[model samples]
Target: MTKVFRLKDLDCANCAAKMEHCLNKIDAINHVSVNFLTQKMVIEADENEFETVMQEVVKVCKKIEPDCKIIM
Candidate 1:
C-alpha cells in the first residue's frame, strides 16, 4: 500500500533526497518518493506494517532534519 504525507521545513531538493533515502532504508519500505517543492512524501510499504513504518519514517526524517515535520 501507499501513503502520502506532508512535510514541513523541507526547503530544498537535497533535503527531500535525504528524507527519501532515510525512508528507503527501512526494510518495510518498498519505495519512497519525496518532492521538496510540494512538501510531500509518497511511501509504499507492506499494509500490515503501515503505521509502524510511518512512525519510523517520522523518526528518521526528524533525525536527518531536526526541523522537519511529517504530517500524517
Candidate 2:
C-alpha cells in the first residue's frame, strides 16, 4: 500500500532528506520518497503495517519538524 502526505515547513533540501531518512529507518516502510519542491511525501509499505507505519511516521515527523503534518 502507498500513502501520500503533505508536509509543512519543508524549507530546505536537508529537511526533506532528514524526513526521508527518518521514515526509511522504520522496518515496516518498504520505500519513501520526499519531494522538497512540492512539500509532499510518498510512503510505500505492507497493508498489514499501514497503521504502524503511519504512527511511526507521525512520531518521526514531529521529531524532525513539529510544524509538519501528514495529510492523511
Name the candidate that leads on TM-score: 1
**Candidate 2 lDDT tens digits, 2-71:** 8888877777788789989988989999999988998999999999989988999899988887877777
lDDT of 1 by residue, 1-72 (tens): 988888888877887898788778899999999998889899999999998888898888888888888877
Give the root-mean-square deviation of each candidate in angstroms.
1.0, 1.1
User: Which residue pairs in candidate 2 collide?
Assistant: none
* Model 1 accuracy (lDDT, Cα): 0.87
Candidate 2 global CA lDDT score: 0.87
Q: Rate the local accuracy (lDDT) of all candidates.
A: 0.87, 0.87
Q: After superposition, how far is residue 34 of candidate 1 from its true place, in Å?
A: 0.9
